[model samples]
Target: MNTTRGADGKRTGRDETAEERADRMWVELIQEVRVAQTGVQILFGFLLTVVFTPAFARLAHTDRVIYIVTVVLGAAATGALIGPVSLHRLVSGRRVKPQAVSLASRLTFVGLVLLLATMTSSLLLVLRVATQADYVLLLVAVVVLWYLLCWFGWPLWVRHRHTSEQ
Candidate 1:
């Protein structure tokens, strides 16, 4: 088997055809989605039950609005995250794995963003109800910043740093 080295100093262990590359990427993407899907599904499920809870009726109007937004975001995240599976299933034998993978990746990215929003809103509502502290917004902002740093910033930095090394 012949192998080529990319400009990034990374050696291609095995030469892969486009289809093979798609197959490998599809598997890797699915593994990543699995982790995210489980979390979002659990959160969405819990959000669905919140409205039926006794405590929900006691929430202020603002809090109830926030809850609705959070639930909607959660539902969207769940749909986006689970989209890849359906996409793959529908296109399984159509010889379009490469395109399917690309679309799925986009959906996964959207799902992650929605998940971030869902978490932020949920936290905001919870904090507002749990305490009258004026620092709740500050606290939520800090957490949002932290999530952005961890979920988006760090990965982007790493990508830039490594790409520049090529």
Candidate 2:
């Protein structure tokens, strides 16, 4: 068995070569992507149906524009989230798991960002339609802040606070 200090200088306590590490990371990344992929795919599917609703024609020009933007964001999110699968398929057995993992991680991160935008836009459209009030943007801003805090801020804070410098 072998052990090595990781980025934070803590011993990983695992006997794994670079290829093994890449394999493990790839599996974990794929699992995480599956969860995000489901959400984004469902959201995109729902967005696709909005245009067919009779009420869609009655929406104000601003609301319609918002819908278009939201749908585009949703599509982008779906594409990014699913990109890893396609990437893996194309690169499988090429002895490049390490590079594939790195690229897949980047794609997942982009997907998450796109997902955030889609959610914000969808919420804005919903609130505007449900309540024609000036406070809608304020509410959307608050929600976006909450999402950022939960999705990125807290994790970063934890990493910064707990990680040891070497």
Candidate 3:
């Protein structure tokens, strides 16, 4: 089989036009977004309830600020994760699907970043409220590094190692 490399260094495996590629990518992007959307929605919902809990009143000022930041990050994550759906709905049949998919993919990436921030902040707040241990900061930093490795490092390594320059 003959294959050509695109400008992005991706080898062409299927004989798809731009529109067909966009359609296929849009479907895949939505499926991926669904997984992230569900997680962020659930997390954001729980974050919303934190303020109403009796324990919330006893939180230190810094912890309260952390909680607020976590909530905001969760909200932003939710918006970004769900942005693709609305983008598709509004742009469907307008012959701009290629652009829409590109934008949606970007939004999904942004959403994931926001989700990471949300989770990190949430963990920090929970740890602060649950313990006075001096190692919480170190623990959180280690966990953040783990998250970064799992969420980004592995995928990037695989991409770089396997992508053939045709």
Top lDDT model: 2
The predicted structure with the larger lDDT, 2 or 3, is 2
Count of residue pairs whose backbone atoms collide, per candidate? 0, 0, 0
RMSD of 2: 1.9
lDDT of 2 by residue, 97-130 (tens): 9899999999999999999999999999999999
Q: Model 1, range 1-166, lDDT digits (tens) per residue?
A: 4354554656656587667778999999999999999999999998999999999989999999999999999999999999999999999999999899999999999999999999999999989999968999999999999999999999999988876432
- C-alpha lDDT of residue 48 in model 3: 98
Q: What overall lDDT goes with each candidate model?
A: 0.92, 0.93, 0.91
Q: TM-score for candidate 2, please give it.
A: 0.93
Instruction: Sort the predicted structures by lDDT, highest score first.
Output: 2, 1, 3
All candidates' TM-scores?
A: 0.91, 0.93, 0.94
lDDT of candidate 2 at residue 130, scale 0 to 100: 98
Off by over 4 Å in 2: 1-13
Q: Is candidate 1 or candidate 2 better by lDDT?
A: 2
